[model samples]
Target: MTLPEKPASGAEQPTMAELAEGYASKAGLHRSSNGNIDVLKSAGGVQGIAESVLPGLVFLVAFTITRDLPVALIGSLATAAAFTIARLIQRRPLTQALAGVVGVGLSAWLANSTGKAEDFYVLGFFTNVAYILAMALSIAFRWPFAGLIFGFIRNEGLEWRKHPARMKAYKIGTWVIISVLVLRLVVQVPLYFMGEAGLAALATTRLLMGAPLYILGVWVAWLLTRPAPAPADPGTERS
Candidate 1:
């Protein structure tokens, strides 16, 4: 989680291309089915999903029932903290649990401060928008996110971009990611603008589109980037 250090003046600094390749390669190792499953388990799996969704659910339900911001915010923060504590007691990695606590805590703070329930979803809405723009820009520049990632994973360097087939595959994979993000915004943005009801809907949308959709996106990317069949040698063909 620490930021990278600056290279010394006399040292040859890594280019952005090299850094991007390294990052993509590292990311690919974690995007596989087994790797993702392990991540899910480390994150507390089904229980983790519930832990993530329940705090917001509690806030929404409490607000709907009593119309009290303090009560709702407290309920959400308390639930998130409880989940984090439970994860710690179980000796599981705290990254996911801590993230849940931080996210819920921040959302509650924003909503309470603004006296607007919709502010709870503002962070997530902006996050999705940021992702969409990043992915789109990468593809438009012909350095598609998926391609860059898998190429580095395979240690193929920038060579994949020179091949029309591989380039097309990566482009398609990047589009899959873009499509999911766009769909999320399409469904949730209007809800984000809807006031109290929108807040509730936005929370629901966030839960629905969270990890499951991400896993699906990974699967689609893998399918598109799987190794292609090698061409037959001319000498092997009948004369």
Candidate 2:
């Protein structure tokens, strides 16, 4: 069966297999002499970002309108529905939305039972994390020997042998953690300098801001994780 392809200019889109093989060929050009590093970039930048972010925007707008946590959550669910409807209307893929609903629901249920409400953000966070990990997991499953680890979402079938200290993955993950922490600070920093009105505005702004970050994370995920390309040779990396 044909996998989906990016739309072309005034021409029919290529099949998913075509796109996959095309990416494979493009990736083949950038191999390290030692055959360890696998570079990745996503082709579905604009479209994927839009699809991913739509739900977040809906949730944020709903939060603004509702102004109550539980009601805002219901609004978030409605936002998800709206996102699904819009995707159907546009004929975009529904896999992301469907998966988001399931993943978000599960995460919410689990967090409520075992973790604090602080553990839960909008569904965007869970959706993006799940989607991105799906890509990495795909790579890990496909090829365990490219000397690489945690292939970013594209899962370009890199050969990952363990590094001396697993330093690279640690570095990337560390930066991601730091960046998230800094962003949380950016959100909270204003509280110190704000009046009642300022605090209200700050809260509103954060409530609204989540949509874009979550969507951007989702978009990044699509890029970071794509389907693994088939191995061309016995020695070639598959993950």
- Scored by TM-score, the top model is 1
TM-scores of the models, in the given order?
A: 0.73, 0.38
Instruction: Give candidate 2's whole-model lDDT.
Output: 0.44
Worst window of 10 by summed lDDT in candidate 1: 28-37
Report how far off residue 126 is in candidate 2 (Å).
Answer: 7.9
Query: Candidate 1 lDDT, tens digit per residue, 1-239?
Result: 99998978889888655664456534523433432223454234688678867888888889889989899889999998998898888887677778888888888889988999878878887888898899889989999988877676555667998899888889899889788888888998898788887776787888788766765776677677876878999988976
Flag regions of model 2 displaced more than 4 Å: 1-44, 103-239
Count of clashing residue pairs in every prediction? 0, 19
Question: What lDDT does candidate 2 reach at residue 43?
Answer: 23
After TM-score superposition, the amount by which residue 54's alpha carbon in candidate 2 deviates from its true location, in angstroms, is 4.2
- At residue 149, what lDDT does model 2 achieve? 28
Model 1 quality (TM-score): 0.73
Residue 11 lDDT in candidate 1: 100
Cα RMSD to the true fold for all candidates: 7.8, 12.7
